[model samples]
Target: MQKVRGVVARAKGEPVSVETVLVPDPGPGEAVVQVQTCGVCHTDLHYREGGINDDFPFLLGHEAAGVVESVGEGVTNVAPGDFVILNWRAVCGDCRACRRGEPWYCFSTFNAEQRMTLEDGTELTPALGIGAFAEKTLVHSGQCTKVDPSASPAAVGLLGCGVMAGIGAAINTGAVGRGKSVAVIGCGGVGAAAVAGSALAGASRIIAVDLDDRKLEWARGLGATHTVNSKERDAVEAIQELTDGFGADVVIDAVGRPETWKQAFYARDLAGTVVLVGVPTPDMRIPDLPLIDVFGRGGALKSSWYGDCLPDRDFPMLVDLYQQGRLDLDAFVSERIGLDDVEAAFERMHHGDVLRSVVEL
Candidate 1:
């Protein structure tokens, strides 16, 4: 066993602190990773708010890149010294999703069998099964996807979560491609990434919509052809005007709210795709809309889970693109911070000023 300083949320609505955490040696199907860079994700903030569950004293970071420190028996997918991005989806090859060749939706994904604990021996519930806001963390071997060592750890680590989700929402779920007209609602990290993904897939017109002009500027840097300040005008009408009175070919709802979702539903050309990538609270229901409209004007209505990405296939590929300069992964990282700065980072989330604040261990 080894002890490391880690960010821990001891209770709901309380500040997270760097605590002494005990990490066990990896057991079967497990590996210990020395985290190099971990992005301050909104999900981590969600865990702290008790919004995810009553799982208290949670270990609070997930989007991370690291090096393998040790592996348990029978592990061969990655090894010590390998550069990797820690993923939450460790697909069970025998699950129904995997057998049918859609392992990205693997219903039986696994995590480390053992637990990391506090000095008093209380178990820590890791956010998304990856508690990487520390010097080292334990995870299922399958969660460690090997990527190019040459890429910046801070830049590529984001592929583990929001960045990947946004990109995947565009390329994989929305099927955005050459000459497609796309509009992504919510110009946050994920939305910006969707804009970038549309460009990467050769989309002709990419319109970015957000309340904040700052985030809209960030979207432009990432390849948005036009910007829409939805707070100033109706999102659907602006999207229609930009798309020549029709609508976007693909509309992504990254805001995950009833109003934004309805806008996305209307901001599409007939037989166009609408993707819901934003996470909505349990109480939030689908907005009141006619059932006939859903049937009449739809190519597809889809909800993107992890952007329907298979990390092993996607992570390395995206990292390679970043390494080659075809994809500007670095633009998403607005600030570099230390572990102690996470609480302040979480506070910064409310204002929506930053794209990403990455913690370098």
Candidate 2:
């Protein structure tokens, strides 16, 4: 076992603390990563707030990139010194979903079999199966997808989650095509990514909707062809006006609230797609709508999970795209701080002050 400095969330609604934790050498099929950078995702905040569960003393960080430090007895895919992007879905080939040829929906994803423990020997649950806000972390060898080492870890690590979800929500789930009109609601990190993805996919008109004009300006930079401040105007009406008065070909709801969802439901052309990539709370419910609307809408209502991405295939491709200067992955990195600044980053996140605050290990 090796001791590494890490950030840990001890209790709900409490601040994260920097401390030393034990990371054991890799076991069979596992590897140890020397983490270079990790992104502060809202999901980490959800875990800190006990919104995910009561797993106290949670090891909070997931979206990350690193170099392989060591491999287990049977590991072969990556070697020491290889750069990699860590992922949660280390898919098990024998699972039902895998057998059905949809490994992305694998029911039996794997993580480090051994635990990273506190100094006092208390076991710590790694958030989202990846405890990455540290000097080193242990994960299944399959979780390490090798990518271009030249790419900035701070930029590519964001691809491990939110950015990937947004891009995938557009290019994958939304099935955006050449000349299609696409609109993304909630110009946050994920929503802005969706807009970028649409532009990359050759969407002719990419509309961005949000309450904050600042975010709308950011979205415009990210390839949104039109911007709508939803607070200032009816979002559905505004979207319709932009797409030849027929709404957009695809509408993505990055804000998962019922009201925003309703706007997305109505802000698409006939036979167009609606993709819900935003997350919703447990207590929220959709209001009554005529069943005829669902039938008359005449298209798919889809939900994107992690952009339905296949990491091994997608991560390397995205990194290459970033390297080519086609994807502005670096623009997403609004600020960089150490693991100790996570609590403060959360404060900024709550106030919508930044796109992403990355932690440099």
Candidate 3:
């Protein structure tokens, strides 16, 4: 057993604090990792707000990169000193989804058998099974995907979550490709990544739509060819105008709101695709839509779960792209903050002041 300082949210809507956490030795099929860099993603804030569930005293922070410190019995995928990115999808190879070869949608992912706890012996629930905002964390060995040690930990770590979700939304789920016209709504970290992915896939036109000009500017740096300030104009009409009145070949709704999703549905070409990578709250529901319109639309309306990514295949390839200067992963690092700065980073993210505020240990 080892004692480590970690960020914890004790209750809903309360500020998080750094507390002494008890990390146990890696049990069978598990590993202990020394976290190097972790991104301050919105999901952490959601966990703090009770938006996810009533799991209190949550050990937050999931998007992370680290070095393996030790592994338990039968753990061969990673070892001491290996650099890796943490992932939640630790697929059970025998699960129905995996047996069919769609491991990305693995229905039986697992986490560490033993729990990390508070100093007082209270067990803590880890966010998305990672809980990496600490000096060290314990996870299922399958959660750690080894990547090139030469890559930037802060840059490549983001591929563990938002960045990968956005990129995969475009390439894997949306099938965005050369000569395609693409538009991404919301222009936040994930949305901007979708724009970048579209560009990387050789899309002829990439339009970014957002309410904040700062976010739109970030999208441009990431590879957006055009931007729409939805607060100033109609997003659907602007998308149509930019796509030669035909509409984009693929439109991604990264905002995950009813209004934005409707816009994406109408903003794409008749045979184009609509990808919803954004997550909606449980309280939210899609409003009434014309069933006739749904029948008339000959395109797909899909949701992207973790961007429909296969981590082992995508993570290394993306790190290579980042190292090769093909993907501007560093641009997403709006700021480098310490563990204490997480509350402030959430405020900045909520206010649209930054793309990503990473916590570098």
Candidate 4:
């Protein structure tokens, strides 16, 4: 066992406290990763608010890049000293989804079985099963995807979750193609990523819609062809006008609200695809839109689960693309801070002022 410094949320709606915890040796199909850096994401805040579950005393932090420090008995895919990105979904090969050759939908995805605990022996629940807001984190061997060591951990770490989700929303879920016109609503981390994904997929007219101009400017930096401040203009009208008055080939609702989803629905051309990457609250409901609209729209209205990404296949390829100067992962990292700054990072996330604040371990 090893003692490592980590940030833990002791209870709901409480500030995370940093403490030294015990990380046990990896069991079968597991590995110990010495985390170099991890990004503070909105999901971590969700956990703190008990938005995810009642698993209190939670060890938060997940989007991270690290070095494999050790491996369990039967592990062969990765070993000590390998650079890797931590993924939450450790797909089980024998699951029903994997048997159908769609491991991305693997229902039996899991994390390290061994638990990380407090000094008093209280069990700590890791966020998304990663618990990366620590010096070291234990995870399933499948959760560790090997990547180039030369890449900056702070930059590549974002790919483990939000960045990958956004890119996959367009490239994987939306199937954005060359010269396709795309519009993405809510230009935060996820929305900007969809814009970048569309751009990388050779989208000719990438329109971005957001309530904040600051975010819209950031969206343009990430490859948005046009920007619309929805606070000042009708988002659907703006998107439609930008896309030849017929709307885009694909419209992604990164906001995940019924209002935004409806905008996404009507903001695309006939038979256009709508990808919902944003998450919604349980109290929220989509009350309007006739059933005929669903049938008449004529294309897929899909929800991207973690951008529909298969981590092993997507992470390395994206890192390589970043290395070749084709994809700019570094731009997403607005700042880097220590573990203590997570609470402040959540505030920034609320203000929509920054893209991502990474914790450099």
Candidate 5:
């Protein structure tokens, strides 16, 4: 067993604590990763606040990149010393989704069969099956996606979750294409990424909508062609005006609220697409809207699950783009912090001022 210090959310609505935990040697099909860096995503904060579930003493980090330290018996896909980004969706090839060739929606993703435990012997639930805020973490070998070691771990790690979801929302789910007019609502990390993805996909007019000017500025840096302060203007109207009154070819709602979703639905031109990447709370419900509007709009309405990405296929390609300087993955790292500062980072994220606060191990 390996003893490692990791951040843990001991209870709902309590600050996370860095505590000593026992990480067992990898069992079959498992590997141990020495974490280099992990991004402080909103999802971690959600886990701490009990927004995700009642799983207490939860290990609270997910977006991470690391080097493989060891692998258990029967593991052949990765070995010690391989640099990798940890992915939650480790596709199980025999699952229904994988059998049909859609591994991105794999019904049975893999995780380590053994559990990490607190010193008291209480089983610890790893956030998203990847408690990576620690110095080292154990995961299924499939969760480790090999990438270029030379890339910045802090930047590339973001691709493991939020950034990947945003980019995938545009490229994979929305099918954004050349000269397409795109609008991304909410302008947070995911929305800005969607904007960047739209630009990368050769979108001619990328409209970024958000309440905060800072986020709008960040979106512009990432490649938004227009910015809308939604607090000061109607998002749908601004998007339509920017698109010459036809609305955009694709509209993405990175804010999962009913209001933002409604804006996205109305901000698309005829036969345009709407992609919802933001996560909603369980209690939230879509406000009533006419079914005729849904049918009359005549466009696809979809939700992006981890940007509908296949990590093995997307991670390496995105890393190459980052290395080539075409994709500004580094811009997402608003701050680099130690593990102790995660709670503070969570506060910053809650205020919506920063894109990401990455914890360097």
Candidate 6:
């Protein structure tokens, strides 16, 4: 067993604590990763707040990049010394989705069979099956996706979660193509990445909608052609006007709120796609809209889970693009912090003060 420092939420609505936890040696199909950096994503905060479930004493970091320290028997996909980004969706090839050749929707994703625990022998639930805010983490070997070691860990790790979600929302889920017009609501990490993805896809126009001017400015840097202050203007109207009065070819709702979702619903042209990438709380519901509008709109309405990404296929390609300087992955790193600062990062994220605050181990 290896004793390592890790961030844990002991209860709902309580601040996370850095505690020494015992990480067992990798069992079959498992691997141990020495985490280099992990991003403080909203999901981590949500897990701490009990938004995900009632699983207490949850290990809270998921977005991470690390070096493989060891692997257990039956693990051949990765080896010791490999640099990788941790992914939650470790496709199980025999599952229905994988059998259908859609591993991105793999019905049976893998995680380590063993559990990490506190010194007192309490089992700890790792967030998203990755609890990476620690100095080291144990995961299924399939969760580790090898990438170029030359890339910045802080920047590339974002691809493990929010960044990947946004890009996949545009390219994979929305099927954004050359000359298409795109609009992304909520100009945060995921939304801004969607704009960048749209631009990379050769979108003719990319509209970024957000309430914060700072986020809008950051969105412009990431290739948003137009910015809309939703608090000051009607987001749907602005998007429609920007898209030649017919609305954009694709509208992505990154905010996940009913109001923002409604805006995205009406801000697309007839037959255009609307991708809802933002996660909604269990208590939240889609507000009532005219049933005729859904039928008459004649376009696809879809939800993007983890941007519908296949990590094995997408991670390396995106890392290559970042190396080539075509994609500004660095723009997403607003700050670098220590593990102790994650609570502060949560506050900054809540206030829209930073795109991402990476915790360097």
RMSD of each: 0.6, 1.0, 0.7, 0.8, 0.7, 0.6
* Model 1, CA-based lDDT: 0.95
TM-scores of all candidate predictions against the true structure: 0.99, 0.98, 0.99, 0.99, 0.99, 0.99
What are the lDDT scores of the predictions, listed in order?
0.95, 0.92, 0.94, 0.93, 0.95, 0.95
lDDT at 261 for candidate 2? 88
Clashing residue pairs, backbone N/CA/C < 3 A, model 1: none
Candidate 4: clashing pairs of residues: none
Q: lDDT tens digits, residues 1-361, model 5?
A: 9999999999999888999989999999999999999999989988998999897889889999999999999999899999999999999999889999999999899999999999999999999999999999999999999999999999999999999999999999999999999999998989999998999999999999999999999999999999999899999999999999999999999999988989999999999999999999998888788999999989899999999999999999999999999999999999999989999998999999699999998
Give one digit per residue, the lDDT tens place, for model 2 in 99-133: 99998778899898999999899999999989998
Per residue, candidate 3 scores C-alpha lDDT tens digits across 1-361 of 9999899999999999999999999999999999999999999999999999998899999999999999999998998999999998988899999999899899999899999999899999999999989999999999999999999999999999999999999999999999999999999999999999999999999999999999999999988999999999999999999998989999999999999999999999998899999999997888679999888978899999998998899999999998899999999998999999999999999998989999999
Model 1 CA RMSD to the hidden true structure, in angstroms: 0.6
Q: How many residue pairs clash per model?
A: 0, 0, 0, 0, 0, 0
Which stretch of 10 consecutive residues in model 6 shows the poorest summed lDDT? 279-288
For model 1 the local lDDT of residue 177 reads 96
Which one wins on lDDT? 6
**In model 2, which range of ten residues has the least summed lDDT?**
280-289
- After superposition, the stretches of candidate 5 with alpha carbons farther than 4 Å from their true spots are none
Residue pairs whose backbone atoms clash in candidate 6 = none
Q: What lDDT tens digits, residue by residue, belong to model 4 across residues 84-141?
A: 9999878898999999999999999988899999999999999999999999999999
Model 1 residue 302 distance off true place after TM-score fit, in angstroms: 0.5
